[model samples]
Target: MIETYLPNVDWTKMWDATVETLYMTAVSTIFTFVIGLALGILLFLTAPGHIWANKLVNLLTGSIVNIFRSIPFIILIILLIPFTKFLIGTIRGPEAAMPALIIGAAPFYGRMVLIALSEIDKGVLEAARSMGAKTSTIIFKVLLPESMPALISGITVTAIALVGYTAMAGIIGAGGLGTLAFLDGFQRNREDVTLVSTVLILVVVFILQFAGDFAVKRLDKR
Candidate 1:
């Protein structure tokens, strides 16, 4: 059955495409996690009831997250083309698509992170404060560690979401499994390539979800 539609096409090429997808997804995920976690921490600390609460800071962070989250990924990609080209010297590959992915994913991930942090026990924070921990110490040593399980889950969710974004990036010529699928399946009318790409994407998502769940369960005391 596999031989019928994809005949004579190198399977290794598909492997290369899959590697490209992983490359884009991994890089974007790391940047998004860092940026999102930082923004999330800021939002939590500056919210009305937190120790470092400041209305202005809270408002600014919230506004920035909302602004980025509101922009559609495809539009953001097109809108960012000039900047992407400037950074990457070509706006049609995985490297070129990265900045937009980071921009699109970071705010959404930030909001997720904020929610996870907000769910941490208020009592734990108070206990940390009573220990005379500084703000930075409380955030890094207390809040972050306490929310590890939730953060792990959030990272899994973000990874899967970014996979979808990577597929869309393929539309703009970012070579990956998606691009191969699009060209062979959509443009060239080969259903087998499409099927293979779809299955590969699902496999990757399942792996991410399983790994994330395992980490969360391992870290979660309750």
Candidate 2:
């Protein structure tokens, strides 16, 4: 029986890993949204036909977002090691991984935001302008409010992606369910431990999706 050969799982370790993973995901998501929302707004405003309409600004910012988004998460983590060390004093642990997680997710989420904002009706902006709305008013009142649902859904997606990143973060000593899966499960040949960690990650992601969707439905006017 596979169960006969299966090693006993350390549930306390699994619980700890669950907590760490949640903490990392929550902190990283907050950081990503703060940075990404600003970039996304800039991208929407600076586009060729958009309100700002600065060619140089659009190209530079768009290029930067693309470059960061194109990097694979695993390699991105490696590339961010020095920056991480500089920020947090060590290249290991949840705190250190925040930089990598934020950097990697922010740009990707920014693009999602760009798409969300771009999809809004041009008439909305036109009406706001006709009403003598200032740029700040257009952005705060019109742009963001119209795209709130999409933004919520986009962040929901980003949170799910961060779940994957958190697991990989464990490879570099960024503690989480990932570390348990690696060191205790695969390295020790404890399939039971591996299965439990994997299951927990699924549960977390599922809960995020359900909660995010519920909020989107509640907040969405349409």
Stretches of candidate 2 off by over 4 Å are 1-7
Give Cα-based local distance difference scores for all models. Answer: 0.90, 0.92
TM of each candidate vs. truth: 0.96, 0.95
Model 1, position 73, has a per-residue lDDT of 95
The local lDDT score (0 to 100) that residue 169 gets in candidate 1 is 89
Which pairs of residues collide in candidate 2?
A: none
For model 1 the local lDDT of residue 191 reads 76
Task: Supply candidate 2's per-residue lDDT for 124.
Answer: 88
Cα error, residue 152 of model 1, in Å, equals 0.5
Worst 10 residues of 2 by lDDT: 1-10
lDDT of 2 by residue, 1-222 (tens): 644544567767889999999999999999898899999999989988878999999899999999999999999999998888889999988898899999999999999999999899999899999999999999899999999999999999999999999999998889999988998888988888899899999999999999999999998987
